[model samples]
Target: MISRVTQQTVQKSTLANLQLNLSRMSDLQGRLSGGKLITKPSDDPGGTASALQLRASQRAAEQVARNVDNGIGWLGTVDSALQTSLDSLRRARDLTVQGANGSMSAQARDAIAVEIEGIRSAMLSEANTSFLGRSVFAGTSNTGVAFAPDYTHQGAPGSSVERRISSDATVRVDVDGSAVYGQGPWDPVTATGSVFGLLDQIAADLRAGLPISDHIAHLDTRRDSMLGELGAVGSRYGRLETVQQGVQKTIMDLKGQVSAIEDIDLAETMVELQSQEVAYQAALGATARVLQPSLLDFLR
Candidate 1:
């Protein structure tokens, strides 16, 4: 069909083309300046969703990383305390053996008793070891110390401190103080299963000039308990170390994914921006030539 081509229609068409070109240039400039492919969600809906999901995951991983660091600190303190306690028990054993000797004089026995008292103090100190003011052996209890002066356990029976290493896994950072150090008098019925109770028994025997071969056996049993806990702590520490590596690697991978999805490729954007600028300028020149000048142009 034949149609009339009016001047106003031509002018409107030219203005629309110029506006479209200017909008394109503006978008490219925004991307270049912001250095992001998706400044607003409208830019790319699917990519924005993916980027948001990846960022949430990254934050979770970062929190797990913090938990790992705290867990390592707690476990390291526990392991070292257990080792030191074991050494103290060994020394106590040697002293017990010396005290059990038939030829040792009364004065010598008394002196050995004094030394055994010192070992007991040292072991108690180790049992109460802490990480950032919280007892490592306290099993989630906020009692501030694992064992009281009377050798009674202060930690909760089964409750423990734990740290999350991943979305699916958590590791216990605190140990069972009652199991490792003995509750009250250790074996309450015997009044002498706890390390402190046993040490007390040894000291009494030494002062009374009584044979203490049994004390040495008791020390061995307590030492074995310390060794078992130490082994367990070591295993957990190794696990945390491995998990930390995985978490760190996962965080790095998540960052790369997000960057790919959201970050602009500067080189590509620069080239596109230059092209858009050229197109916009050409559109402006073309529009100026096609449209007839108004009365304002005549007055000017």
Candidate 2:
């Protein structure tokens, strides 16, 4: 025997179909408004997870780029100070050469010594140069001055300031002042004579009419050390620039990946929305026609 269909079952089926069509339309409208496929994790769990991961990676790359910029600034400050110090040392060397000439009178030698002293003072100031309120050549020391008042190195030795430019890389942004200027107490016997001490001794020799050949050699050595440090600073600056470029590119790529995972296809979504609208209207019309007549009409 065949089972008889009831009007109540027919009405229930129509209501369920209508509800499903309305839900589909609502979801399409939401995607259109938001312009993204993954409005919530439930929309597309795998795609939402990928988007979150990419967003996190993008943020980290941006932070690393900022660190690279700060590193570049610190290295630039150090390079500028070293340049000024190098110039002052060269000037002091020129005066020393002139003072060493036997043809120069005592008064003339005294005048040269005075100028050399000024150069030495200026070099000391450069050594104590600071960037962002911290000594650039003082390693990790937060002291405002890299060198003490007595021409002694005041910055921490063997400690460097480093900035993380990438996941696997850290770059040193500071120089070791003690290595370039020698240690404090400026010992001549211990081979730790600073440029300041060397200039002071040269000034004394000029006044006493003593030979300054050894002093000239020491001056050259200090100048060489300064040059080496300057070169290292330039190298680090160049490396930071390269890292900055790489980070910028990584950020761009990560953003693209996130967009692909999270952003909606407007054209395709619009087409699907129009199709759903047509189907929903068709279902409503069919339900209206099918439910128009009832059991009362059949009894009449």
Candidate 3:
């Protein structure tokens, strides 16, 4: 009876060791198959939390990048319009200068005035530029044309809009059209009126055969004002571009961070997985040998 009891005890111990080795092999298999140790919170609470945070940051960064893209598009429209405005103003100024010359007859000056009027009309049309159905120059108001039908600015003074590109980064989405188109330290129009208005007045003086040296002189001053406004618009364009670059950099950094948190290191993971596979194979071999023992072998 004592000998039989000893045999039973040995068998039970061998079975327990076999079960333990098999469990270890199963764990190794799991690790080899799944690159990450924490597929779920139950697998590793801290890793799960960290991954969640990283994913969240990545999503936020993507959305901000979209915002930056939209802002850049809007800025591009403004830049293009300002370029057109400058060109038109230059042409108008030339016409004014030509008309002011004494060698030209009144008929010639009047003919030139017609052309100036055309340029002025074109400038007015340009001022009403829109982006995605919203007025680029309409202060904060997006409902309609940037300028009134009479070519006056059509929104609240000093109203501006902004867009966020990152947690700490933001940029203004517009520069006032009135400011860019006329005179200012930043007035949208001159005391006399907008560029179109001044051009109309100049054209009228030339048509009436009135002495237009004074009109030309006023236009030259307004030309300087227009040039100043163009410079300011150019500066704003540069600033928006600078902010866009910053947002791009921030997006790149955030992408790297996200990759670090969520993406597997392929080289390292492959090495670890190979190691786990070898370990599991070794454990399987050991357990097979241990569990292969039979009653006949024991008797022998």
RMSD of 1: 2.6
Candidate 2 runs further than 4 Å off? 1-3, 185-191, 207-209, 287-300
Give the higher-lDDT candidate: 2 or 3: 2
TM-score of decoy 3: 0.76
lDDT of 2 by residue, 97-138 (tens): 888798888999889888988887888888888888999878
Query: Model 3 shows how many backbone clashes?
Result: 1
lDDT of 2 at 264: 82
RMSD of each: 2.6, 2.9, 4.8
TM value for model 1: 0.90
Cα error, candidate 3, residue 85 (Å): 1.1
Query: Per-residue lDDT for 180-258 in model 3, tens only?
Result: 5552222223435677777877788788876556555555665675566567656655766676687577668876765
Model 1 worst lDDT run, 10 consecutive residues: 183-192
Clashing pairs in 1: 186-194
lDDT of 1 by residue, 1-300 (tens): 999987788889999999999898898888888888898999999999999999999999999999999999999999888888888888888888888997999999999999989988888888899999999998878899999888888998778998988778899998887777775654524645678878877888788878788667767777788888888999999999998999999999999999999889999999998998898899889888877578798799
Q: Which whole-number lDDT from 0 to 100 does residue 65 have in model 1?
A: 92
Error of 2 at 62 (Å): 2.8
Taking all chains together, each candidate's TM-score versus the true structure is 0.90, 0.85, 0.76
